[model samples]
Each structure stands twice: as structure tokens, then as C-alpha cells.
Target: MSMSGDPVLERVRAIEDDFADAMSRMYTVGNELATLRARLETEASPAQWTPVAEPAAPPTPAAATAAPQPSPVPTAPAGLVTPPPPAHAPAYAPAAVPPPARPLPPAEPWWQRDGVVAKILAVVGATITLIGVAFLLALAIQMGFFGPVARVTSGALLAMGLVGAAALVRRREAGTVGALGLAATGIATAYLDVLAVTRIYDWVPLAGGMVIAGLIALGGVLLARAWDSQLLAVVAVLGVALMAPFVGLDHARLTGAFLLVLTIATWPAQVGRRWWALELARVVPTGLFLAALALAQERTAVPVVLALGLAVLVVGTTVAGTRSERLPLQLGALVPVGVMPVWSAGVAAPDRWVGTALLVVATCLLLLAAGLVVHREGTAPQHRVPEIALAAAGVTSLTAAPRAVDGGSLAIVAIVGVALVWAVAALVLRQRSVLLVAWGLGVIALLGSLALLPYVVLRSQAGDVGPRHLVTAVLLVALLVVTARASDRIIPATAPVLSRALLALAVVSTGGAVVVSGVLLGQLLDDPRGGFTAGQAGATVVWMAAAALLLLRGLRGSTIAVPAGLTLAAASVVKLLLFDLAFLGGLARVVSFIVAGLLLLGMGAGYAQALERSRREGTDRTPPGPPPGPVDNPTAPTPIPPTV
Candidate 1:
């Protein structure tokens, strides 16, 4: 270790000494720099500045304590000084230039500079650790030594810890630790309260213990607010404490109460409007409800939680969608929508019908409201309300309608009628989705109506035409006509040719429906099993003849009349061949054939006569007046050309 023995080693030691000395001076200069920074902070203003240098000579007693003039350079680089003037310099000196500004210090990360990450880890770790410690405490109390005093001791600890945390928050010294401490206290309180509630043979009333747990959370909220964003984490933990009941309690009402508390705790923070609160609100309630639903022994919990959660989700989603928070709202709403359909499917019989109707109605109303609110609050595209409403209704109907169909005719008719009514209303209101649905259902309805006639005939033949059946048919027909007329406005622009063809079809279908029903009504009064008989076929033939001749007469009113006449004549031929040939015999069959044939012949003659009369009337109309009569009196001599 002796330096004298090796010369090179001595030189190395000398260099080390120099480096050490240089570092020591750097430390000294840094301290001086910190002092200067402190002084500058107190002394600086627009009109004042601290002096960077002192005069060489000491001030006289009279001049002591007076302010010094500011130097041209407020601060100089370390180890440099103002240079003395040269002997040959001019007497008048120009103004001195200022020094370069100091470089700003690099900013420290929050975790490194302010202990943010450490504080979060400390508080959350402490809270989780406390729960384990509380179990130990509970275990110690369970042993014979201190079982009676366990509640008193744990309650005292919770109160003391909360008091200390509140004091820290109040002093503004706790940062995240205060909120975490508060949350840990809440977690401990929850453990004790739940234990008491479950082990009810103990002395403490369950309700009183729950009140204490609530107070713990309430105190946490107030303290957390003082800790800035720490309050959000605190609120979330409080939500977890509230969710504890969902795990251990079998009471359905308590689950609801727990969820409600969780909902309030997860509400958007009023202070600074903590943005994460929105996401928490969406998630925490769902988690609570799901946990409650999962743990419940009672079937009633499903419906109750579903209804409550749906209410919250609906308001939240609408608010969220209105605010352009679409993805979260969509994700939040999807769960309930999926679950509801499955729930509706699982419901049995009469209640199932009620549930399905509610689902459909709810879907429609939600869609309509959402579309309107979005359209009103935002710039939704045209037809948004109806399109979304109809689509949603269709989805709901598909799930609900098949079950309804399984319920029999009344169910089928009721569901179909509802869809029809909504479709018609949608069409009348200029909703394109409804218009499309209306037309589709119209086709179905038309086919359904045709199929129904035979059933109606069979029933009436068996004496089944009561007043109720008659009334139902009348209502059904009225609704169909209303639906058709409502869609009539779009005729001109939407394939006028096809639209006219549809109108013709509608006309033919309606007339045929009336014909069948009216003829069947008379038969019901006359005989129990009267179906397509000779007299009925003959009556139908005469009805067709009247329709054909009437169309021929009204050809001037509509181009469709000619086709209508031909259609009626063809119907007459079909009755003669099918009904009269198959069913009727003897005099009845002969009369039917005679009546049908005569009707067809008369229809053809009438059409021909109408066409001839129209052609003759066209020929008698005025002509063009003989081409101006050859330029008039060539006699006037023609004034010849005037002289220029």
C-alpha cells in the first residue's frame, strides 16, 4: 500500500486524488447553485432582479443595507469572471450582452419522483394483506381464549385505522395510501359484517353490523376525495365490499340491495369527473348482478336482477351512445340482449307467451327510443328510427313468434296481427323498413287468407259459424285493407307497372274473399253441412257473370277491367268443370253447367259490344278541317312584290 515504492503507481494515485478533488468542487458548486436558485425565486419580479456579483470594496457604514444594481449578466458560467478593460479601450463602452439561459432540468417520472406506483402498491397490498390478517384474527377469536372479545377488538382496529387514514388525507400528506388504507378498512369491516350475518347465533344484530360496514365505505369516499384520483380506486374497492353479499347471502332482496349500492359507488366521480368511472359503472354492476345470479338458490333472483340490471343498462347505454361512447355501450348492452332471449325461450306456457310479448314490445320501444334520441342528439341518417325499430322488432318476433305459433291459432293470429299493425303503422309513417315488412306480411296474409277459406267452409258446414268467428273475420279483413291502402302512396315511383299489377291482385283477392264468405254465410243458416253444392256453384257462377259484365261496363274507368273480365270468365269455366262436374248430379248439375256456360258466353258478347261501341265513338270525333283550303282567294291578285 506504500506509494513510494512504485513510481507509476504513485502517478496513478496522484490522478485519482485530482479526480476526487474535482468532484468535491462540483458538489460545492452545486450547493451554491441551489442557494442561488432559492434566492432568485424570492427576489425575482418584472421590475426587480437579484445582483449576481458584489463590489470589490466593502460598503461604508452609511451605505450598508442599500440595494445593489443588477449586473448586465444575471448569472455567469461557473469559474468565469468579468474581464478587466484594456488600457487602450475607448472611454465610451457599449451595452453588455446578456448571458445564455440555463438549461431546464429533465422531468422525473411520477413513479420515480412522487412515489405514485409505490403508493398504489402499498395501499392495495396492505388492503389485501389485511383480509388475511383478519382471518387470522377471526381464527384466534374462534379459539377459547378471546372469542367473545374478537368483535370488540376488530371493530376498534377498523375505527382506529380509518381515523388515522382520514387524518392523513385531511393533512394532504397521504397521497394514494390514505385511500388504500380507507379501502382496506372497508374490506376488513365487510369480512366482520358478513361473518356476523352468516353466523347469526352471535350477539351482534346483523342489521347493525351492516350499518357499520356502510359507514366504513361512506367514510372512505370522503377521505378518497381528498386523495385526488385515489378516490376512484377506493370507490371500486368499496364496490367489491358491497359485492360480498352476492357470494355468501341467499337473500334475494339483499343481492338487489348490494347491486344498488355497487351502482351508486361506481357512479361517475363528481370531482374532476374521473373518466374511468364510466367504465367502472358499466362493469361493476354487471359483475355484481352476474355474481348474484350465479350464487342464488332462488329462481326469483334471475328475473329481479335481470329487470334491475336492464334498467340501469338501458339508461347508461342511451346516455353513452348519445355521448359517442359507442363501443362500451354496445358491449354492455349485448350481454343483456343475449340473455333475455334465452330467458324468454326457457319460460313455459302461458307465462312464456307473456314474456315473449314483453320482449317484442320492449325491443321495439328501445329501438325506437334509441333511434330517436340518437337522431335528435346527433346526425343519424334518414329512416334511422324506423329501420332500427323494425329490424329489432323482426329479431324479437322471430324468437317469440314461433313459440307463439306453438300455442295455436289464437296465438298465431295475435302475433301476426301485432306485426301487421306495426308494419302498417310504419308504412303510413313513411318508415321504409315497415313498408318492406308490410309488403312481405301482406303476401303471407294473402296466402293465409286463401288457405283459411276452406277451413272456414268446413267449419261452417259443421255449423261452426258463431257470432265471434264472424266478428274476428270482419276485423281481420278491415286490417288487411288498411295495410294495403297505407302502402298505396308509394305506387307511382316503385315500378308503376308492378304496382298496378299488385293493386289488381289485391282487388281480385278481396272480391274473392267476400264472395266465399258471403255465400258460406247463407249456407250456414240453411244447412249444417252445406259446402260446394249445386245451388252454391250456381250462385257463384251468377256472381262471376255480374263481376265480368260490370268490369266490361267500366273499361273506360280502368285498363285492368278487361283482364278482370277475362279472369271472371275463366273462373266461371273452372266452376263448370270442377264443381258442377264433380259434385252435382241430375237436375242440379245440369242447371250449374247451364248457368256457368251462359255467363261465359254473355261476358264475351258484352266485351265485344263494348269494344265496338268505343271504336265507333272514336271515328265520329271531329276531323282536322281539310288542310287550310288551298291558301284562300288566289283572287286578291297577290299584291305582288313591293318596290324597294
Candidate 2:
């Protein structure tokens, strides 16, 4: 344990330290190799390999001669290796390889770099700054900071905002800051202008500042297109809104017209497989606006304007049809026909002659046009407007005809002939209700004339009965026939009700006619020579009986029952009155009262039964027969005969 013995501890400590250093050097070399391998794997290529350098030392005799020493032991090869014996070698010594320098990481792209964050922040700050400035400008304008100068200033601000927005949209390179700043400035200016214009005028401000705003918006839209920007659509929408107030003003016509033109121009934007609805929505409003304007004014220009509007409507409808390939537009094109009637009504003179003639002509033309439209469209059933109009025209024309000839005699025969033909035709071709009703009324009118003309002539000769008598008789008979026909047709299948209605009407008309005739007879009796003879009275009674029989048969569901019953009833009433005057003498009064009461009772009972039967049958008793056929229900469904 002296100085020589202490050397052993020192040597042991040194050996341990050397071993530790060698392990450290080996670990460091291994880490570098692993890193290189990873880099080579990531960027797999032959460029990573390099040739090994030759050693500086020459092999000694022992090394060269030693059986080709096993390849120099590699540190941490597949398995562990023990060190050579100290007796064969001087000592174990550690060797270290210099560490490989790491390559710098690839630089980040500009967008992902820190500089981008700064740029974004700068843009946001600029946008906020621009928005704040605009807000302050608007506040200043509102406060009248520049008085009239405010207007120019505001206009300039709007122009600048619009230009800036355009530039931002064009320079796609300008990040979010430029875009936001532009949008805020443009929108704010437009809003301020809109406010200023609205304040100046109560409703429509399209004339002043709003116009400028609209122009700016339009510019934005164009700029956006030029720059391939989406902002244009937004600006265009704002422009449309700005122009909306102008639609309410009289002078806004120009603005409205402009908008319409713009809409038409932009219609292509809506062109696509799926944009039909949007396209329609876009174009229809312009047409509607024009139509409203045309309707609101009263100047002479109104007609021309309306005509232009009609043209626009037609064109718009046509375009919409082409674009959407839908039938609604085609159907809607017929709406202008309704307008013509309104115009005709407005222009019609109060004088019956002129108005009647004009109406007849207009109606005829309308009927022809409607027919053409229906034919062109090939719409069936619902397209009966022409037939309906023709029927209306026929009836109206008949109504306008002079009731009495120049001789003051009623033109009963002529009127009856016309009415009969019309009624028959209407019955044969019953497509439209109006036509049917019109023709039916015409027939009733004719029948009424035939029944009453004789009485009128008789009264005229006697100078007793006035126009009032003729009018009352006509009214009563017409009402009877109309009500009877309407009830029958409307309740076709309800046989009992229809039959009863016919019978009831027959009884009423017959009985009423008889009563009226009896009164006339009594007045005649006051004059001895005026009294009817016995034969006449008998004939009258026979006529009355015949009429009653016809009515009874009608109640049995005969198709011809109503007309036949009405005719017989009329004849019978005439006969009854004649009989009373000729044979009843002083009993005429009693006979008339009794007959009238019986007739009333009969009619009331029949009507009640008919209504009850109709209720049981689950049908309306009011008459309305089949749409097309005879006035009565045809037993068979007759095919429509071809027209000549």
C-alpha cells in the first residue's frame, strides 16, 4: 500500500475512465449513423452514398502476414464482440469519428411564414381603419359638417369607395385587408347616400344621392366581372335595392326602364339547367312594374303605354317560356285579353246605341282572338273562351236590336226566330256556362215576346194596357223559364226535384197568366161588346186543361216537359180568362179566385215535394242540366257532331 502499490488503483481508475469515454464516443457515432440513415430513407436516393477513404498507415509485417484478419470489428454490428487479449495487444484504446453537421430545415413558404401573420394583421388593421374613416365621414355628412359641400364630399367618397372596391376585386393578390376595406367603404358610402336621398325626399330617392350609389354598385358589378370576383353579385344586388325606391316615383320611370333593361341583359346569368325559376323571378318583376305604371296613370299616353306594356308582357312571357320550357308562361300570355275588356269598358260611351254597337264589335273581335289563341295553344275544354265570347256577342247583339219596329208594333216573330236558333245551338255546344246562360235568356226573351205581343197589340188597340203590362208579363214568364231550366240542368240526376220544379214553374206561369188575363177580361166585360163568347170560354178552359196535363207529365220526368208545360200553361191562362168573360158573367170573380188558389196550392206542394226529394237524392233541386245537349237531359251521351 506504499507509492508502488497506490499506482495499481490509479491505473484501475484510468482504465475505467477510458472505457467510459470509448462508450460515449461509440454512442455518438451510432446516433450520427442512425440520423444519416433516416435522412437517406426520407430522401431515398443514391446521392447519400460516398466512397470510403484509404487508411494513412501501411500494414506492418505482422498485420500483413496475419491471416487476412477478420474484417475490422465494427462497433455495435449485429451482435456484441469482446476486446482482444492484453497479452497480444498493448492495451485497449478508444477511437472516435467526428460528428456530422445537421442540415438546416427547409425555409417555410411565404403564406406559412411569420411575415404572413404580420401581413394579415396589417390588412385587418387597415380594414378597420378604413371602416372607421367611412363611419366618421357619414357622421360628418349627417351633421352637416360641410353643408352643401357634404353632398359633393359624399359623392366623392362613394366614387372612391366604388373604385377601391373595384381595384380590390381586380387585384386578387390584395389579401383580406384590401377586400374588406374595399367592401366596407363601398357599402358604407352607398348606405349614406341612400340615407341622404331618402331624407331629402319622403319616399323615392332614386333621383339624387341614391342614383350615384346605384351607379357605384353597377360599377362594382362590372369591375367584379372584369376581375373574376364574386363581389359583383353582391354589389349588383345592392344596386337593385338602391334603385327600388325610384320605382315609386313618377319620374322613376326612367330608372325602372333602366332596371328592366338591366334585368334583361343579366338574364343570361340565370341561364342554366336549373335556373329557370330564378330567371322567371328576375324578368317578371320588370313586366309587372311596367304594367302597374300603365294602370296608374290617366293621361292620353295611357293607351300607348298600356300597349307597350302588353307587348313587353308578351315578349317577357315568350322569353320565359323559352328559358324555362314551361306552360304557365304560355297560359299567362292570355291575361292581356282581360285587359282589353277593361280598356273597352273605360272607353265605352254612355249612349246605349253607341255603346251597344261598340261592345258588340269588341266582343266579336275578342271572340275571334280567343278562338285563335285556343286553337294555337291546343287547349281543350278550358279553352272555350271563344265559344263563350261568341255566345255573349250573340246575346248582346240581340239585346241591342230594336224591340219594336218603326210602326210601333213588336217584332215578336223575328226575335223569337233568332232566340230559338241561338238556344238550340247553345244547347248543342255547351262548353261555356256564360254562353249557355246567355242563349237560354235569349230564348226566354223570345218566348216572352211571343206570348205578350198579342196582348200588347190588343191593349194598344183598346188604349188600355200600357208598356207596364207587357213588361210584367215578360218578366214573370222569363223568370219561370230561367229558374226551371237552371234547376233542371244543375240537378240533372235528381229526377224528382227537376220534375217537380218543372211542374211548379208550369203551374205558376199558367196560373199567373190566367189571373192577369182574367183581370183583362173583367175590364173588357165592363163594356158589353168586349165580353168573350161562350165558345171562346170553352176553348180557354180546354187550353188551361191541356197546360195542366203538360205540367203533370213534366213532373213524370219527361225531358220536353218544361217547355211544353209552359206553352200549354200560357195558352190555358189565355183561354181561362176568355171563358170567364164569356160564360162565367158575374161568377168570373169567384171562378178566378178559386182557380188562382188551386194553382198556388198546386205549385207550392210540388215545389216542396221536389225539394224534399232532392234532399233525399243528395242533389241540389236548382236546375242545371248536362253541359252540352238539349235544354233537357238527353237519355244517351251523344257524340259531338262535327261542325259544318
Candidate 3:
């Protein structure tokens, strides 16, 4: 209140007040401008006006005005002086006439409004209305209000009329109406035709129905292009519907082929505008074709179907790669390649081998391509999918080839070898954990094949050095070496599951070898005690026990002791079988029980030890140094050296 007494203080107060007032005014102006800008930008067609004509010079008063009046005397409040008005004040009177008002433009149609909520309501209303109409039509058809032919004819005509009306409507509304109408018509047509086909002319009625459906769909497509609507999407849905009837029919093969060709031919016509529809169109027809081919029990179409699928996949992947760069598309492209092995497994003997070889080559090529893609564009995750697919394809083909070809024992060995090499190469180059695990699995599979196949092929001719025992010994050693070398790479805690799987494979293979040996070779040998006799059953048990011990020590995680223990327990079974045939039954049962008990105890102890060691190590390494020293004196130092 007394700031005027100090000049510096008074000046500073004045400056501060002025600054505050200026900032307040600035903020107000900024807020007003921002609000106006937002309102203007949101308008669909923001308004701007041009001058129609320059303002007419203010009308000159006719000749002279009435006599000029004298100015009033100025008044001021008690403490203020009144300022004089400017000298350039106008001397004339006010104008008599007013300016004309501008006329407003016409209101927009309701459907074309910029309000999102209103538009959404309209779309929902239209969809509901269409559904109601479809339901009514279906009810009318079922009620037989008109003769069967009359109902069909009237429904078709009504659909056509609705489509025509939709085309003439506004473009925005046309899409919704056209799509709904086309879809309804398609469903109705398919239902009626399918009923007629099954009940009346048996199978031949399908051909005529398909032709009609095809024509109607084509009409929809043409109308869509002409009217610039999304009717093609509806047309695709129609095509799929028409194909469904034939899907269940016995002539699925023929029908599928026809639809597939038709869809392919129509694809180019629908390239840019309706890509999702085009993709759906291609997928449905191709899927039907494959299904039909499979159901027909014909091997010849396998190659043709696979080749066609590959073509579609390549084109689809290329489009996706260029347009979107999504990983799913790249993965989708590899699906055909993945399925090729399954298809090849069904072909004739000679063709199957050729097909398997083709698949392997194709898989390798795809892997190379995926590598290139990854190298060129490091950001794309799509490239990894193809590599994964390639590995999968290799595994599938090798497994399928032997059964498909009906080849000799050595052929299975060759297939497993190929799989192992392929998997190892993938692991070495990629250093991917999934690939490494797959490689290990492939090795296990190879061992299984080698152990079982030769004895199966040799039948009664298996001699003293039959390959079964040799393969088993080699596989056991190999598994140990591989597991040992890869231990550091594999997280010890998670190795149990993988080790269990391998152990399971080993059990099945070894069990299968024993069965094959007994069935095939045991009958031929006169002495029945010559080579790899049941006497070695105990040795086999010891070998398995050793393997289990190694696994328990090396793998410090979950123990797949079940399979391991089972392997050892199986020796008792071998002993019992030999003794039963040799007429020493009671002794055999006693030895079997003893051996089984020992195996169980040994496995349990080994598993418990591993689990205890894991727990101890985990506890010892935790933070917050070992509890506390025994001494209660805070200042007293207790000295002890850390030991590893």
C-alpha cells in the first residue's frame, strides 16, 4: 500500500503488475485461437469465403445535411482530467440503409453426415434390417407359400432387384446393401440347390446348381466393379458357399478342381481393390481341392495339388512381403512346403522317393532364401519362420519316405542320417536352441531306425553278429557323448524333459529289437543259445544301469527315472522268457523279482541324490551371507576364508 514512497520499489511493483496483465491476456488469446483451430479442422469441409464485390462507397448525402449541431461540454470526475477527442473526427451524419444478408447452402443428406455416431447407428440399422429380410425369405421358402419353382424364381428375382436398387443408391450406402443382399442370395441358393441335389436328380443336379451360382457370383462381381462397392467380398463368400455342397458330395474331387480353377481365373480381376476377399477366395477353393483329392483315394493328384499349393503360396508370400512385411504371411507361404511331405507320403513307391527328394531340395532352397531375406533386412521377423518351416519339412520328409517307398532296412537308416545332418547344419549355422534340440532328437531317431530296421529285414537269416546289439551299444554311447558335450549349452534345470523323451525313444527301440530278435531269429537257431543269448540279459541290465547313473550325475534336474528304471527292469522280462522256454520257471520268477527290486532302489537313490544336490547348491549360493557368526560380541571379528 505504501510502495509509492520508495521509487525503486514502486517501479518494480508497476513492472510486475504490467507483466502479469500481459501474460493473462496472452494466455486468453492463445486458448481462444486453439479452440477455433480445432473446431475448424474437425469440419469435413471447413468454410472460407471470397468477397463477391467490393463494398460500395457509402451513399453521399443529397447535396447538404441539416445544420450542424454544437459539441457538448466535456465533464471529468473529481480527481481526473478529461482528454480531448481527436481532431480527425468525422463531420457527417450516419447512413440510413442496411446491408443485405447472405444466403446459407442446402443441408447435406442424413447418410452423408460427418457425425460418426449417427453413421454407426445407420450401419447397424441396415445390418439388422438385412438379417430380418433374410430370415423372412428363408421362412417363406420353407413354408411353401408358392410352388417350389415359383419360390426359387421369386427369390432370385427379388435378390436381383435389390442388388439393382443398391447400385443406384448413394455409394456409401450401396456397399452395405449390396453385400447383405448378395450374401443372403448365396446362402438361399446353396441351401435350395443342395436339398434338390440330394433329394431329386441325385448327383447331376449339382452341376446345374454350381453353374447358376457361378453366374450369379460373376454378376455380383461385375456389379461391384461397376458401382464401386465391396460386393466382390460378398461374391467370394457366395463362391465358398456354392463349393460347400460339393464338399460333402461323392464328386468332391471334380467339384473342387472346377471351383479352384474358377477362383484362380477370377483372382486377377480382383487384384488391388478387395485383397482380403481375394485371399479368402483363393484359400477356400484350394482347401476344398486338397480335401477332395484326399477323400477320393487317388494318389495321382498328390503332386498336382502340392504344386498348385506352392504356386499360390509363392504368389501370396510375394504380395505379403512387398505390401505388408508381416511374419504370418511368410510363415503361411512355408505351410505348403510343410504339407508337401504329407502329400508325398501318399504317392506310389517310385513317385514317393522322387517326391521326398524334391521336398528335401525344396526345403534347402527355402532355407537359403530365408537366410538371404534375414541378411538383407535384419528388422523383419518373417525370415525366421521360413527357416523353421524348412527344418520341419526335412524332418517330415525323412520320416515319411521309408514307409511310402516300402524300401529295405538300409533306406530307413539313410533317411535318419539325412535328417541328422540337416538338423546339425541348421544348429551350427543358426545357434538356435530349438534347432539344436531338434538335431539331438534327430540323432535319437536315427539310432532307433538303425537298431530296429536291419533285424526286421533279415528275418530268420540274422547271423551271430546281427546289427541290433551293435546299434544299441553305439546309440547308448552316442547319447551319452552328445548329452555330456551339450550340457553347458542346455540349461540343466530344463534338461530333464528332453532327456526323458530321449530315454523313451531308447526304451521303445531297444524293446522293439528284443521282440524282433525273438520273433524272427530265435526260431531259426537250432541251439537257441548261440549269439547275443538271453544270458546277456543281465549284462544289458547293467549297461542300462550305467547309462541311468551317468544321466543322474550329468543331469542335475528332474529325473526321468521311470524310463531309466524300466529299461533295467526289462532285463528280468528277458530272463523270464528264456527260463520259461527252457523249463526253469520258478527260478526265473525269483531272479526277475530280485533284479527288478535292485533296479528300482538304484534309480530312486540316484534321483534323490541329484535332487538333494540341486537344493543344496541353490541354498548355499543365495545372498545375505551365511546366517550369522556364533559370537554375540558385535565388535569381535570372526575370521574364515571363503572356499569354492
Candidate 4:
């Protein structure tokens, strides 16, 4: 590569070339040797006749005296001969051979190599061109440079021309950035042109203009579908969505209608495509527009209907698809649908009737979830959709129950009842996620239910415990127990952490239920002398009794029961010593001590008996002797051995 060639450099180049030739000759000689060996082996096969051994005759004197002639030197084949280094070349030690070259890295993917840059540039260029067209239309209108008809005609003609250009470009280069970009821009331009005709020029009525706009949006969707381009579909939807407010001109009804029309127009694109971006483009704008309408406190019949219809359409399309989609996609589709009803009930209507309607909607969603569970057939996690539906149903019920009921206590009871229903449904369906949803709802409702119960059971009066409180507590206890059982069935034992947590919840709920029932019993008894203290003492007795039962179960060979029994026993002791000793007095205190002592004594006696029985059984199962073996006293046994 060096042009200013020194003599040493030239000599080095000559040496390199000579080395290359030598290596080539060495390889060629090796190959020739291999070929000759193969040919020799083929000719000397076992099938060929070989001479037998024979006795040798006496050697002649001349033959013995003559020395063996020198063997001739073998020459290499003509082309394989390696040339010697030139005499003029400097004599030097041999250089170390260089390492082999490293292979090149893999090439970037084609889309990353060029397509991304092209798409970005095309979309930006299209946006800029649309902005320019808008400015031109505005300038023409401001300057009165042309009459209304001429302006409308020019804009419409320009939009049509762009659409034609899109078709031509697509025909030439389908699925390219230029085609998608052009189609999106043209569709947006046509919508804008239609808007101008209806609003600015008054050449078309609002109704006619809306119809034309919807058709334009629908046409864009159809073109995207034909092209099979998600990017174009999303762009087209977004383009129309961005311009929807301009068409509606701040009229809430018109805006909601336009949004509803857009959603309907874009619905077909999402049928089986799983085009999440396109779905988001359709849903987000519609949801946001409706939210704005709700905030403005406009008459919301249109918004409410649109929200409900959109939710049903989304769920139906997603669930009806034959292909398995991801759980996140299914859940994402439901999120907007779930949140929209709050505004409808609270701000738009603010009436019990609307709340009742929401309850009905919740019931319907639950029914759909049940139907999905019944009809679905696959190993896939289709159950997750129903799980999410149950969660949404829980939220809807919680929101509606307060409005539907007259009293706070009744509302709390209703929420707890709803949670219990979800838990039961989950148990029936045998789905883990549904079970988790049930537990989550139950826990939340339980927190609300805590307000209905007296915080300190022993401090409350007899009147504090009501049927509603007792019912709510009972429902919560059942809900937790059901969900815990469901978790055991639906969740694999491999997930030890979740299983343990559910078990803990079940145990806690059981203990709480005992205390609650004791408190309620004392209230029902209407003790004339300090029923509260009596109730506290009774709770301690119940605790000790529950602990004894757990210990007995543990004694019967249940591994999990041992630790639980120990923990409950310790808690019972602590409550009896610290709480009952300080709170109870008179006969109540004496009775509590006596009962706790008896329970402890019985538990200990039962445990000891169980251990003794186990040891006895183990002894009975063992052989009477260690086996027939060597005598323990070997020397003493010699007397008997003599007889043998």
C-alpha cells in the first residue's frame, strides 16, 4: 500500500510472497501424498494375489561383494515446487506467524437500518405539509382572496388530489412509509375540508357534515385494512380524533356523537388484528372526550350511552377473537370501560336510579364473566379476563351500594355481601386470579366494615352490637375463609409465600369471628352486671378453647397445626394474663382464670397422652427381640456351645 517504496520494504514484500508460495507448495505436497497413499491402498487390496514365502538359495560372490547403489532423489510435481528465496534477499531469523483474522459482527436488521428513519421523515414531512395547507386555507379565507364557493371547491379539489396521489404512491410502493404517510395526511385533509364546508362556509349543515366526516374516517380505516398497515390505521384514527373538537365546535352533544362515530368507524380495524396501538388510539380519545363532557356537567345521556356501547364493543370484539391474546391487552381494554361509569353515576346523574342502573350493569358484567368461564376451551389463561371482570364488578358494586342503600350500615353490609359473592364465584370457577380479586375486595370491604363494629369490644355498650354489624362480620369471615380455601385449590403449592399468607388470613379470620360472636352473645344476654367485662372474659375462654382444639389436631399428626396451635396458645395465655387480669373482676375474673387453667391443663394432658400412645404403638410395631445374633457374654456361652 505504501507508494514511496524503499528497498527494505520491497525486500519484505518479496519475502512475504515467497512465504505464501512456500505454504501453498507445502499444502499441495501434503494433498499429493494423501492421493498417492489412497491409490496405493486401493491397488493392494486383500482380493489381489500375493506370492508365498519360499526358501532362499546361496548368494553368489559378485552379488554379495557389490554395494547397494544410492537411491535417486524424488522431485516434487512441477506446479507444486516451492521457489527458493533470492540470493540478494537479506538473511534474517524467521518471523512469528500472525494470528488469524477475527470474523466481522452481524449486520443490523433492515428495519433498523433504514425503515425507521424513512418513516419518521415521511410522517414529519406530511405533518408540515398539512400545516401549510391549513395556513393557506386560513389565509385565503382571511384575505377574501376568493369567494366562498371557489375556496370550498379549491380545498375539496386539493384534498381529492392528495388522496389520488396517495393511491398512486401506494400502487407504486405498497407498505412503504411514503404510502402510509400520504394516506394519513390525505384523510386528515379531507376531514378538515369537510369541516370547513359545514362550519365556515355554511355550505353544508352540521348533520350532513358529520355524515361526510364519518364516511371519510371509515374510508381511511378501510384503506388501512386493505393495505394491512397498523401504522396507517393508527395515524388515520389519531388524525380524525385531533380534529374532532373543531368539527364539534365545543358543543358537548355534537362532540360525544362525533367521538362515538369515530369509535364505530375504527372498530372494524381491531376485529382480529390485535393492533393495540389502533385500539388505544380509538379508546383513549373517546374516553378523554367523554371525561371532559362529564366534568363540564353537560347533559350526559349521549356520553353514558357511548361509554356503555364502547365498553360492550371492546369486550365483545376481544373475547370473540379466536386467537389467544395476552392478558395485559385484555385487561387494558377493560380499564377505560370500568372507569367511565363513575362519572355517569356521580356527576351526570347523581340519583339513586343511576346507581341502581350501575348495579344492573355490574350484574351483567359478572354474567358475561360466568359465560366466558363456561364456554372457553383451551389451556391458555382465558380465566384472567373473567378475573378482571370480577374485579371491575367489585369496584362497581362498591361504588353503587352506598347510593342504592339509605344507611351507611346497610351499605357496608351490601359491600361485604358483594365481596362474599365474588369469593364464592371464584371458588366455583376455580381460578387463582379470580380468587385474588375476591380476597382484595373482601379485605377492602372488611376495612370499611371495621367502622361499623366497636373498635374495643369490651368497652362498648350492649346496644353497640347490631344485626347489621353481626351480619357484616359473619359475611367477612365467610368471605376470607372461602377465598383462603379457593387459594389453596387454585394456587399451586409451589407458591409457598402466597399460600402461607392466605392461611394466615384464614386463621386470623377464624379467631376474630370467635371474639365477635362472644361479644354479640354477651350483648344478647343483657347481663345486668357489667356485660362488657363478662364478654371480654368469655372471649378469653373462647380463645383458650380454640387453642386447645388446634393443639389436639396437632397431636393427631398434622404438621401445620402444630405451629398454629402453639402461636394461638401463646396469644391466649398473653390475653388471659395481661387483659383479663386487668379488665375482669369479681366472679368473672375468677371464672376466667379457672377456665383458662382447665383448658391449659387439658391441652397439656392430651398432648402427653398422644405422645405416650404414639411411643407405645411404635414399640408394639417393633420386633420382640433385636434379632437372633451373637450372645452378649461370649465366654459364658462356651458351656452351651460344647453341647452343640
Global lDDT of each model? 0.51, 0.48, 0.49, 0.66
**After superposing candidate 2, which stretches have Cα over 4 Å from the reference?**
1-140, 145-301, 304-426, 432-546, 551-644
| Residues 1-644, model 1: lDDT tens digits | 67678989657555554544454444445445544654565465333333433212222323321323232212222443323345533222323447768999899868786666766775676667667766866687678555545665665666476656646664664455554555555545554544554344345544444455555555555545555544444553444454446443555455445545544554433334434444444344545454445334345545444553544454454445545543222322333332342334233324555556555555555554444444434443532443544555555554465555554555435544655665567656766566776666555555544544553434344344343333334445555555555556644356545554555554444444443454456566674344335335645565576568557656686766666666666666775677557755676677767776776677668778988888898899878686655655456556677789
- In model 3, the worst 10-residue window by lDDT is 60-69
| Residue 548 lDDT, candidate 4, scale 0-100 | 76
What's the true lDDT of residue 105 in model 1? Answer: 89
lDDT of 1 at 270: 36
- Candidate 4 has what TM-score? 0.71
For candidate 3, what is the TM-score? 0.46
Of 3 and 4, the candidate ranking higher by lDDT: 4
Q: What local lDDT score does residue 610 receive in model 3, on the 0 to 100 scale? A: 73
lDDT of 4 at 37: 53
lDDT by residue (tens digit), candidate 2, 507-615: 5444445434544564566632232222234335545555556656666677676577667666556645564544455554465546644764675477568747756
User: 1-644, model 4: which lDDT tens digit per residue?
Assistant: 76646898657555554544455455465545544554565476534322222212323323322432232212233334223445432112223445668999999886788578888888898889999987887898799887778877887787788777878887775446787787777787787778778777788877788778777877878888888888878877887787777777656677677777787667766755657778778877877776666555555466666666655665665455423443223333354353464435343455567646755674575547535533345535533465556666666666666666744668888888878887897889886666767778877886886774353344544456566766776677677667766777787672456655655555555555555555666666765236556656776776777677777787778787778777878887898889889877999899989988988898889889988998899888967776877768546544554543
Give a tens-digit lDDT track for model 3, residues 522-638.
446653333224323433454456556645745544345445555554554564456323532344345544665676677668777877887888899868676876877576377
**Model 1 lDDT-worst window of ten:** 64-73
TM-score of each prediction: 0.47, 0.36, 0.46, 0.71
